[model samples]
Target: MNSDCVFCSLLRDEGAADWIWRGQGASALLPLEDGRLAPGHTLVIADQHAVGVQDVSPAALTQVILLVQQVSVALRDAFGARGVNVLNASGPDSDQSVDHLHFHVVPRWAADGLDTWPGGRSGHRLGTQWPAELRRAVTARQL
Candidate 1:
């Protein structure tokens, strides 16, 4: 485990945080940030100290995905969210503040006022602007 990682400490003391759910290899904790995004925004994280998705073991990655899905479903059921956004920032360039691998399950409503798009005025739509080759390169099949 990374001694400097805050998530590792959180996992060690699960009760210290606002945990929505905790599984053997992963857990869903309530967002520490101000709840501007959504009421049930959660951080689904691996218990192990994986710096990024590429560093995670297959079993650990599976557990984190399972927890993320579970938290997303719960957000929909409990908070009346129409949709959910599953997001992960892997490295520094991706705006990952923490080194530990974590997924944000942000519940979405019609008028949540959060800009899901990172490119504010690029006028880029997902399937429209992305080149076919670039899309293929980033697609889940490559992973």
Candidate 2:
């Protein structure tokens, strides 16, 4: 394990986390601190120390997706959330903090009032501007 890597340390049981579930190559748990959002938000992380989606193997990717699905259902059932959003940030520009392949399964309630960031009059719908190649790649994954 990478001694200085926070995520690696977590995977090795060298650090503490509020673990909710663990499986062959992934885990899901609640964050210890509240962020810009509320508490009880969950983070689903790969057990292997991949830094980003690009570094995740196909098997790990599949497992992570499944874990996210499971966690989403559980969080909704346990917390009575109106919905949940699964998110990932890849690089520094995108605000990736831990440098580990992880997905945030944020439980959203009506009272949270978390407004999405506003984009200044971009000429495209929020996610519709994704390049065709990128869109095709995502669609092909059947994820």
Candidate 3:
């Protein structure tokens, strides 16, 4: 574990907030923030330290996402949230505040005033011109 990472410290020390769940590959808990960003705002983090998605094994990432799904359901039931927003900031240029990989599961409701995505925008863009080999490489690879 990285001695400098707060998440690592939280896990290793064991005096952190109440854990929602914990298992072989992932753990869930309320974020250690000044206050909840939204009702039932929780974090699902990989048990092993990894800076981003690319840094983790597929099995580990799968475990984390599965836990996120479970926690989202729990939030929906416990908080009566209409829906939830599963967010991850995976890289240096991303809005990730912590180095360790984690996903924010924020409960949402109508007019929650939480603009997780940019508002006042009509549409978004996707790159049509792309590297054909990128698709080929992924599809051709064996597990």
Largest TM-score belongs to which candidate? 3
Model 1 global lDDT (CA atoms, 0 to 1) = 0.83
> How much is the lDDT of residue 93 in candidate 2?
61
Q: Using lDDT, rank the candidates from best to worst.
A: 3, 1, 2
lDDT of 2 by residue, 1-143 (tens): 45778877877888797788878888987776845255557888998888888778889988999999898888788888878878898766668988888998888898687755555665646565579878788899874
lDDT digits (tens) for residues 98-121 of candidate 3? 999899999999998888875576
Cα lDDT tens digits, model 1, 22-119, are 78999888877674367788899998999889789989999999888888788888888888988889977677878999998999998878877677
How well does candidate 1 match the true structure in TM-score terms?
Answer: 0.79
Cα lDDT for residue 23, model 2? 87
The deviation in Å at residue 53 for candidate 3 is: 0.9
Q: If the candidates were sorted by their TM-score against the true structure, best first, what order would they fall in? A: 3, 1, 2
To one decimal, what is the Cα RMSD in angstroms of model 1 from the true structure?
A: 4.5
- Which candidate number would show the highest lDDT if scored against the true structure? 3
Report how far residue 95 has shifted in candidate 3, in Å. 2.3
Over 4 Å off, model 3: 119-128, 131-134, 140-143
Instruction: Report the Cα lDDT for residue 11, model 2.
Output: 73
